[model samples]
Target: MKSLSLLNKLKDYLKPIREIIYGLTLHEMDLETKKARGNLDQLFMLVVFGDLVGLPLLPPYYSMRLLPYIIPSLERWKRSVLRERDLTDFVSTDL
Candidate 1:
């Protein structure tokens, strides 16, 4: 039928636009997922290494056991945790 052909043509014309929108949405979701993963990593590090900051919630033996798995990120986590932060630092960074 003419109507069915017109509908098919309309969908063909919009396919590129649909693909673009889907790609953009997927990209945005991926970025958000990465950010969330980073936040969780930071929190896990804080809990595991809190003793360095004098919290000492976990036993040293367990912390050492988990240390090897997180060794790559240890330096950056230490720097971020130990750095002196002012109100200006809070304002400058995306919290």
Candidate 2:
């Protein structure tokens, strides 16, 4: 019982310290990774379904075949592709 109590206290004491270390060391890297992944997902969507938005990179038959798998994210992909961007959008991600 004493050992368990001490271990719980140690964990509670270290929790904030561990989070602080992660915030300082890993948070930015995690954000960058997520950003890169989202960009790649959008790019993949563009290649597979660009015809929907008028770019026509793939044949309609192929896009149609993949349509069911892609349906859930289609609206989000379209919005991201069609939205306006500016220099600030690029600048914010770098910092």
Candidate 3:
């Protein structure tokens, strides 16, 4: 009936509103997860190829093997790691 159809239409209209509210509440959590993932990725890359910066934790051969696959992001990652940090950078936990 008509009542059931009206209920369904109302639900369809509210679906987007419900998702928006859920997204708003979880936005911060999603940002933190992304930041943590980036940090972990950097740590993994460092462990695999720390020799590039003169920290020979791993052998050069293994690092070279992985170099090609990581080359694309290597420059950006290096810049991020090597960039100078100021007091504001230390204070900012947004990342």
Candidate 4:
């Protein structure tokens, strides 16, 4: 409720809602992103870069300000985002 107004005010500046949802679809699938596991990174990026395409989660000020809170989390998120999972990982691990 704190900044819901800001979000509504900036609605026009948001990125394409659909692309924010799908931008990392293939990459995420390829990484075998666990359910609920990739949600935050995608959410963060969607906020950080959403305007590039229409549906940003938070206003830019909030997004930038929120960055500090997620700094440590962001590093881990980045690791997960950049992690490469070879097909062999699936082949090697128990299914």
TM for every model, in the order presented, reads 0.52, 0.72, 0.59, 0.36
lDDT of 2 by residue, 1-95 (tens): 99999999999989899999999999999998999999999888878776767888888888889888898998888899889998888876556
The local distance difference test score of model 1 is 0.82
Best model number under TM-score: 2
Error of 4 at 74 (Å): 1.8
TM-score of 1: 0.52
Give the residue spans of candidate 1 off by over 4 A: 1-22, 59-61, 80-95
Name the TM-score of candidate 4: 0.36
Higher-ranked by lDDT: 1 or 4? 1
Q: Per-residue lDDT for 1-95 in model 4, tens only?
A: 85998888678556666567666556466555664456756676656555434666677677767766666665566576688998885563423
Worst 10 residues of 3 by lDDT: 86-95
Model 1 lDDT per residue over 1-95, tens place? 99999999999989998889888678667766897897799899988778667787789888878878888888998888788988885563333
The root-mean-square deviation over C-alpha atoms between each candidate and the true structure, in angstroms, is 6.8, 2.6, 4.1, 19.0
Which segments of candidate 4 are over 4 A away from where they belong?
A: 1-34, 49-58, 88-95
Record all residue pairs in model 3 with backbone atoms less than 3 Å apart, i.e. clashing: none
Ten residues in sequence with the least summed lDDT for candidate 1 = 86-95
